[model samples]
Target: MSESILSISDNSEVILHFDLKLSDGSAVDSTRVNKKPAKMVMGDGSLTKNFEDCLRGLGAGDKKTFEISANEAFGMPNPDNIYHIDRSKFAADTELSDGMIMGFSQPDGSELPGIIRAVAGQSVTVDFNHPLAGQDVIFDVEIIEVR
Candidate 1:
């Protein structure tokens, strides 16, 4: 008798390597580059439902590429996500430069990355939108295991 193969499903645990790229062919991220595979449980909220759907129905050793719209991948950027912070809030030793990314702690103690857009005398404009927001993504996946 032959053994049955395990296919990806909503209840399955999966280990895979993936690459994220932009429309310009720029590489955003890739586990294969790091030589580290990722593990996740389906419906575990680690990934967007739409993105997870792309992994469904695949078995171990399966490789595929998928594309998702900007909204589906990182969502559209919101103007409100940008803020103007007082330069005085930063420590004197801290460097403040336009186009530099810095972390700001929220009330919940979570850190959010903000990109500095402008640095006026007292007011510094920072954008909190994710860098990948409003950009479409190409995802390449290699399924190492599905159980």
Candidate 2:
């Protein structure tokens, strides 16, 4: 008797290695290279609904490459997500530089990460957009297990 293909389903938990690259073929992220295969449960909201849709029919040992639009991946950058903070509010000893990502506490006590975009004399601009925002991405996934 032959075993079933063990396809993915809404009740499944999948373990896989995923590599993400830009349209230019420049790799943005890779679990294979990092040696960190990820575990994702369907309907858990860990992966976007569209991203999960791509994994829905694959079986264990399957490897496929697919393209994900920016909206389906990290999403488009929002100008409203950017904010300017007063340099004086930061610690005197704190080092602030452009392109630096730092965690900030919101008034609601939530921890939000913002990337430094500009450092003027007193105003520091921070962007909360995901680094991959507004980019078409390639996803190469190798399914290790689907249970």
Count backbone overlaps in model 2. 0
lDDT tens readout by residue for model 2, 1-147: 998888988979999999989989999888888698999899998888888899999999999999999998889999999999999989999999999999999899999899999999999999999988899999999999988
> What are the clashing pairs of model 2?
none
* Cand. 2 TM to true fold: 0.92
Give the TM-score (vs. native) of candidate 1: 0.92
Please give, for residues 48-118, the per-residue lDDT of candidate 1 as tens digits. 89889999899999999998899999999999999998988999788889889999999999999999999
Where model 1 places Cα greater than 4 Å from the true spot, the runs are none
Worst 10-residue lDDT window for candidate 2 reads 27-36
